[model samples]
Target chain A: MNPEQLNSPNDFQTIVNKIYQNEQFDFVGIALQSSEAPHSIKWDFVAGNTNERFRKIVLRSGIGIAGLVVRTGKPFWDNNLNHYEFSDEMYTPIAKTESLRSAVAIPIISPLTNLVRGVLLAGYRSNKIKISGQTALTLSQYL
Target chain B: MLETTRWINNYFNDSTDAIMIFKDDELILSNQIAKDLQNELELNPQYLVEVADSSVKQKFSPTDNCFSCIIQNKMKEISIPITLAKNMPHPLNYFMIYNVIDQNEKVFSLTLKNRGTIDRMDQLAQQRKLTQYVNRAHEKERKRISEDLHDSIAQGVYSAIMGVRRLENNHFTAEEIKELTTVIESQLNDTLTEVKEMALDIRPSVLDNFGLLAALKVLAKRLEENSGVTINVAGNANTEHLSDDIQSVLYRITQESINNALKHANADEITVLLVAHNHYITLEIMDDGDGFDVPKYQHFNGKSMGLMNMNERVKTFNGAFKMESKSGEGTTITVKFPVA
Candidate 1:
């Protein structure tokens, strides 16, 4: 599996849909940094998103959920968004826009460079889902 | 007699101290100053003698006649010792003139003065200044460690990874040796990545290298990605002209405010704006989330360390901090620093 082949936006969308179907998540998406504007990252592909607002949101390297994964190259998950320690102001924007109640974000690391190339997010809108480390490992296998 | 009375009236009226005349425990005369003093102390002038006598007795000894002894003393100006309530802004000091008008009259002239309050306030201000200094030192250390990690340890790890990768091609001839080298190389790369992340988390190198705006852009971008929250940063302030300390404090305040909003607010969006003008810089963070009770959160014991830390950081540089929020409304934090 060539890294470039997996990097295609369409291929990512297909993968996102598969993850959403397999995991029974309410929302699934992939955000990749633009090559021309490396600092600017956007959700290039999504499946089961509540609205189109997430697609229009342009993220910077350290700004939001996907940006955090991209910035640190680490996976993060919140079993319950409401119970999480993050400020409501930071997550409410996307949580409300997408109606996500719980979520997990995994960074896709490029093996050659050992750098995060994208983030894969899976979540629910109304129900709480405890996305454990095993779930992240399973998702990473697809990448 | 009329002339003497007029002279006493003029003296009582002209005197600045809160003066009251007591003829054998009877409130005979009190000046306007005395009335004003009573009002300020929230006391009743009608019972001034009884109140003072009881308070003095309670402070000294229940059986002692300290108040009467002071009044009976023959000294022209005798000081009456009394203890003020702990919460009172000023300690009460009183002086009495014994037999001022006539030897047989037994009239006592009492004067009240406030001098201890101002001294106590000055002491409190000094303690606050010392606390601010300690906070500044703490922040400085955090910045130093962040810089050290980014400049020294992370860079060293990168070089070591490169060196180890080069060894895999030339030195490891056996297949098993080559495989072991590959495992070691991968572990070292993981350590390098961890070190880099730790450096950024401690303090972003971009903050020191560029300035506040660039640093904020990086923070906002990453926060948005990790939380799926929308954060908009708009500012044209050239932080390069500002001192490193001011820039660091502002960056930290911005970071903490964003973190607070994300973890607690359940908000939809956050907007940060920065402006510099006329030797002053203003930074504002606004969030459209479920706002909190500002006073309650501020006073809530140990629950708002983040807010307190932000306030202390701003105070270190003599900046003004303001936060406004209400339940179901939203929250906004603004800080202003004088660059000049």
Candidate 2:
């Protein structure tokens, strides 16, 4: 499609929603480090039947699940928040807001400079899940 | 007199109390009490003599050396009340001696009581002491295990994730390989999340790093997200100022309370308030969920250690813990501790 077609938040959300339509995933969203808003990472686009709470969450770098992945340049995931333990303060806000039982976030890097500038977040509300290599590559491909 | 003497001899033979007669610093008459009491001292006989000299002479009086005799002695009795020294085996006793002239100034002496019970009780208390030591060792072990997982294992997982990213740069074809790579990525992502969650649950880095406010806020947010319950949390206390140990206790207690509410109480709304007033920090968790009879589920049986565990944490800081609930109302747990 046109590059301008993917320019807006709705467009991004529409595209992501179509991609994961048949998948078992519960929610799929994209977060980019916003230069317009404090230069920290924020969830710019979200798709799927999401709670109104997600809209109010303006994430900082290393603050929530997406923020941690984007800031640390690493992918993070957990199936059960209650069962799995985390020591960092960064993920607490994300864990609380999303009610995400099992979820993963992979850092998305620029294809040219290989510089991580965003993250792809996918999660399920049921059991704990582990993101495999193939799923990680698929996520990278989409980005 | 002979019959009495025989009974005295028999009784004295088995008794552990010191029974002796002294004549001019000579042990003229000694019973099993002497052997028992002497062995219990665990000190040089010379020390006993010195102690006796210092005490007996000071308390001694001219005519009172007999039954009414006043013997100068500073050797005060050491006994744990509610228990007998000889019978309990926990205390050691002693008997001093002083010379008394019998009719012809023969330098005959009377025996002063000194009985010790420590050796007897040592054997009994050994098991108790051992169990206590083991419990302490186990507590330290738990802490160490939690720390190692947080520091080493969690860090290792993060590093491996970075290494996986390094592999992504390679040219990959074959739909199968690409698919396999995605699977690997998901597995790593899952593992990383699990590791982080484990570390946080055991001991949150926020509680360790920024303090209780940040941690509690995180906890409150989580309760809201998962249960679809709106948890409004507000705290005026300086959570960052609380001691790390206290912070952990509060964090754990809050965790258990929230978990219990989620699992048992089908509550729709929960509110947490933490405030510092008059040198005490107070935390209250109130839920408008389905409440239950407080006395019905009060036992700390094996099934649910939730309240029991929270009680233990509160007790560690000499704090007060109270929970209130009703069949149809809801449950509220309040914990308070001094700002030590």
Candidate 3:
């Protein structure tokens, strides 16, 4: 994939949708931090959002799962979100809003600055779908 | 004898304390004060035995033998602790004195006085002191914010304005003007950052938008970054159903607890847990730090407003607050609020 293509919102949504379709995940989305407001992160594109709540949320850095990824600049994944003790409070709102059970979040780091600029999250509502850290790293290559 | 009888009646009626006369285990006469006390205490006049059984039965036994002892002039006075009602402000110290009227009827006069009124008054006074401490905390916070604005943003903007006015001068070269503009722009950016920090300190917008859990996560992250203490937040509580007022209260409480742990407790790790149940919500913050003697700071002495503020905030929502700690051991603060 060309680096320039990722700059366009339309192309970004198309790529996210394609990843959701190719991986057969229940949900896939992207949360990008606004350049003007560095503290704000919004779910710019969501492939399987049940409601508009995800779009309305302006996640602060170090807040939700996406915020955690952005703050640490690291990939985060949970095989079963419910079983993850530390992420219980972190994932409830996002999981309930999107009907997700297991999820993975990978920070999209800028090549030049090596700082996290956005997050790519993929998950499933079905309990059988287990997301592993290896799968998150594999998907992160697409970014 | 009629004049003396009238005088005795007036004395009994004018007594401040409740006075009841009993003869042979039956209430024979009660003064106006006694009637008022019965109504105020919500005691049943018909079940005098049950009343005595509930109040004086445990301590003095108000039984037939005791009454006989008093009538026989063996016991001069008997005092027993009596609670008029459950959850009353205080208990009363009931006193019974042996007396004879006209040498025809043997009688016992009962009087009730509140034993814990002084304690209750002391509690009210302490509460007033706590309220004043809370006010001082608010006042200090306001002063800090004002000073931050005046010292940083106000000065930055004043310099920027002076720079713009200087740019109007024709004596300055193009390069000099460009450099001055860059300096002014940087100053403006710094001022904006300072204002944002002040706004966040007052009330983080994320708390209102994303609820308590999100706000707490942000707080934990900030505290960890600043203090180098690792904070792990666990448990899932759906705070979307709660009112904004409740969310704000819980967020502020957690914020204060974390701050106290960072500043006072020399701990390397802190854990915060939030859980929601059928009827209530629970929040626990524990730190592996050197703990202080809890009893020393439990009173309203105006030195430790952090704990007091957290306690008052929890109480405002009718919540239960508890703190457990020991010297050299860790401290844990727990708060529980009923879901409304």
Candidate 4:
């Protein structure tokens, strides 16, 4: 499915597949917030995942990669993850399960209200991947 | 106040130190501690602004503030001295202030922490942590001793009692009765030996009567016989010039090390060297067994707390302790103390 065809939750997987096929990423995922009180975020669509454990990851705002992007409405990524503590509870819920050493996440904002509604993540399994602002800008173009 | 930020106000208001919040030069909220300071210094709300040093003022301003970016800067800051209208009970009035000013939210807070109060709080926190570690180590020891009594000593004695009762109720030949009596006698003897070993564990009387060398040698011989391992103890720590406390500490450290080697290391041979020169004593224990990661177990580990407990004991007696270990290699512990 193309970006213009993202009318249903099932279509989100095609967008993830589109990004994964067009990029040099090992994994591509989309996480969206629920429209309710105590709005939590979950991985709605993913491509090239090693396992289905990402479906079990539910994060609050300002927590993991997706949650942080939704909370701060800023692009987030770790260029060098050599010293990143995998056992830290803050990021381990997704990073450990997916074995992701580095990732870049960008917010998807609703143009009308200027509020972040979802996040798009492109990541690699190797720690040596150096994701920069140019890389985040490249990923944001897909959103 | 915005409903979203009401919780921050409530949280800061419950602090034990002086905290005052400002919104566009208007005093919005003040905690009880801040009210007390205002009364004692005869100060107005403006004091929070003027009391801050120029060095701190350069940090950030409330309007168009980006202070949150640098909020976690290093501490070790100089105290802000205050000249007050009224005299305080302290010899000098000084504060170490922590400020959080948010221009976007249009609310800023300044918390004036008394230098003396901060020092007292740091000392109390350290004492609390130390008390908890010591209590945990103490409780672990008590559990081990209880397990020994219940599993080995109590069970042995119970079985011997049952054997004696069976001998009374059975109709047997005189020869069989003699053999049974002998068996019961040996069982009681073994229980007696276990009781003696436990008493020795508590505090060996040899340590008081014959001094450190005799105590360590006797301990080594008994452990060698029980564990079927060779333990070599060669030390001339001549206990004459030492006080009773120093002697006991040395004995306890050595005992604990050997026990660790036998139980955890699975070592076949161990060596202990204790030497006392003119003004200092050095003790070293080495074992040929599997060693573990030192830094990993140096923290609050219940099963392997012997290292930290021994280190604490040595430090209490004004001694230096050093430990070296490597996986598949062996463990070595050295302790040194200055003598008078």
Candidate 5:
């Protein structure tokens, strides 16, 4: 809730872990854009991740789902990502590397700037997901 | 023999060389191609004087033994490629450099050669050019369809919404009906926005009315506003010489490169510079991000399609596409196209 609350990596990891445990998601992750490089958002804390590929993933604003969330400051959800028409740059590398099918991304507002400095995403590896905008609204309240 | 001569004439000055003489900035004498090219000459390769300031550099000269250095201390000559006319190969020019003769005298001659004479490969190049022609036709259709959506459908939707709004002004309308009308109005507004965005994606209209320079500046500004990324576009060039297809191709290449920088490279900033000389137009795109291995990622799955499309478009126009990237460093793409 405060700036100091998320100062430590352990604190961020615990938050991601708590959300992953509280919510029924196949995978959950928190991607942060550092002030040093505000354009790049890197997934720092992830729970229930299949591999370490998410760690290596770097996303720019308006590119991937997390990046889009950070850029737009709005939740993005898609049941059939492959069917949707997206920009050519909308690759969603995390979803591909993690084998995630359905995903929901929510903006994480910084207490300091009152602006979106990070993105929290919950994804499902299953082919079908009953998730909707309503689910994203509920998930967003968790933060 | 006639066909051969015509084919040769299509690319060269009677299959020989177009020669010209330049004393400082003044044109003394020139052949047909050189005369045609003289009109478009802006920057007169002033660097030739700088290089001449040192010593003359030559590519390879057989006439070196014939000419004596008795006239001007040393017979100075520099052979370089210069484009005399559009849609023609850059002729390797032989310029006889000299000192700035008193206010009236420094005289230098420029000899232009046909660079290449590959008649056998003409048909193959034409076949590739045909493929590019087909691709361009598809994009033109897209532009037409985009215009239809913007002008016709979007306008129709607007009038229909206006009709609905006017109908709601009547006192006979019930509360439920009014709410339904409001819903319909909002739905129509959403459709209008979506249609406008789709039309923009199909083909930006600014690219048509304004030239590539203005269009690129607008695109960079819009993208930078959408995302917090720093995108700077800088350069000045006369886009009139470029054909519609080549201009579109160049714009697409720049757009795709910027997108790639944001998506793949995690770039924070991107800079694009476009410069055109008499012979060719050059576009340089640079991004500051954590770069990756270029060779390894060149063929990486679905993502490679974007790279392939960009490459194919450049090749379609006979442009040179060069990409340099290092892991953790950054990526830079430099593209050069012959005026032809």
Candidate 6:
């Protein structure tokens, strides 16, 4: 997983596409820290067609979607993301990138101290789609 | 001409007050009261009617009535003092009308005057009560901080210092030296444990850094160590995500209850149950400690600050707090605070 080898925009997309191709999810993406990737945190990895709007977002700790998981060191799951209020302004980059409607994020913690380092965001454009606990665990196993 | 006569007649007939109507400088109608009031002022009924008629015909403004009217805003329903020529028979009480306004602005202020007196008294009383409450809150915070420092960091330092002294003073037989080293190591371990427990108790960095569940585990450990009591805590709350105030109040109440049980109850076991139901958080603390007669204790205590403090904290958030205890029976304290 040297990102340099996957320098093309579709490189990260290839990983998410492989997962969704075998699974039932609508979209899957990897949100790495800007400090780690140095280019784009929004479309760092995309498995679907996303707009230029995805690359416009920069998140601070404890703020937007991925930032909350990173800062709190907790995984967030919303089976019904539509029921949850979305401050879309904070997630405009993500929203535009995948045209996402419902979403969930899990923080990948360090193996030793269990500190949060990055996030894996999975979402769908359909209102009826939900990310269940089983699905989240399954996604975590892969991502 | 015919329409003017009808209008004048209608004006006098429709009003209860003394009415006079005119149009195009002609006196068309005058009510009996108007004629009488006019005559009492040594004004010929006909002549006074003519003057009033002409004033209305000219569309005289409110300023024109200033001489006879007390209230300036004509639009206001008010009591206006008019010179009635000493011959008018109606009482002065009839002069006022309720709910009147002067072109939407109140010309006559009907407010209760001298409200300043009562308001000042109320403000003083409020200030005094607020000051008293603030003082009590400050005192509680100070006590919590002091107890935390004494029980945690201070005790830790004392243990560590003793350990270091034993290590430095190395003039003893090999057997005695072996014992001394063991004592030093024990002291060091105890100090470290104390530091961590005290830090957790004073402010469970877990509650702040983590959440209520982590903090509760810390509190349970502290209570067990200090009281020689076993506290069984159960239930899973996504407490890390709960609001700060709820977490604080629950923690404080739990801490206080455990303290009371340890100090007053000769109980060997305590249990804390937390359940989330119906968008509310309920906490139950039960102890198999010696219970006192509820009524007798209430009368004897006469508002213990500890109990009062808990009640006050609970009430501030519009929560419910209850204590159930009977002599020869164990005690149970329950608190429920809404989250959603």
Candidate 4 per-residue lDDT over residues B122-183, each given as its tens digit:
77886677788778768966986797688557866885687688787988677666545554
Worst window of 10 by summed lDDT in candidate 1 chain B: B94-103
Per-residue C-alpha lDDT of model 5 across residues B1-340, encoded as one tens digit per residue: 9999888556555424555556765656556665554455432544444444443433233345434333334444444433333444643333332433344666765555454533336656755765675677678767767765665456547655664765567553375454445434533543554465455557877778888988888778655543446789999888977899888988888888887776666666799999998899999999988787778755424323566567767998899888998988899999999995
For model 1, the stretches where C-alpha displacement exceeds 4 angstroms are: A1-8, A18-23, A30-43, A51-82, A87-121, A126-143, B1-211, B236-244
Model 5 spans with C-alpha error above 4 angstroms: A1-143, B1-199, B221-228, B277-279, B296-305, B315-318, B338-340
List candidate 2 segments past 4 Å from native: A1-8, A20-24, A34-44, A55-104, A111-113, A125-132, B1-231, B234-269, B274-283, B288-306, B309-320, B325-330, B335-340
> What is the full ranking by TM-score, best candidate first?
1, 3, 4, 2, 5, 6
User: DockQ of every model listed?
Assistant: 0.11, 0.03, 0.02, 0.01, 0.05, 0.01
Candidate 2 per-residue C-alpha lDDT over A1-143 given as tens digits, one digit per residue, 9 for 90 to 100 = 44324446676676578656846677777776553423334566766535555544445444455656755678777555544333234343344445567667888664433545567787776664566655655665555
Cα RMSD of all models vs. native, in order, equals 12.4, 16.4, 17.1, 26.5, 18.0, 25.9
Question: What TM-score should be assigned to candidate 3?
Answer: 0.48
For candidate 5, give the lDDT: 0.67
Q: What's the TM-score of each model vs. the native?
A: 0.52, 0.43, 0.48, 0.47, 0.41, 0.39
Who wins the TM-score comparison? 1
lDDT of each: 0.70, 0.62, 0.70, 0.71, 0.67, 0.59
Q: Could you tell me how far off, in angstroms, the CA of residue A96 lies in candidate 6 after the best superposition?
A: 67
Question: In candidate 6, what are the lDDT values of residues B87-197, reduced to their tens digit?
Answer: 557422223222212423322111111234446777788657657767876797688668656754565467557646765775656755554444444434444554675
In candidate 1, what are the lDDT values of residues A3-63, reduced to their tens digit?
A: 6578566788788888878877888888775554223456788888765667656554443
Clashes of 5: 1
Give the per-residue lDDT of model 5 (tens digit) for A1-143: 45547767887788788878987888989887654422345788899987665655655555566656755679987676543222444557667556678899998876543456678898888866667898789777667
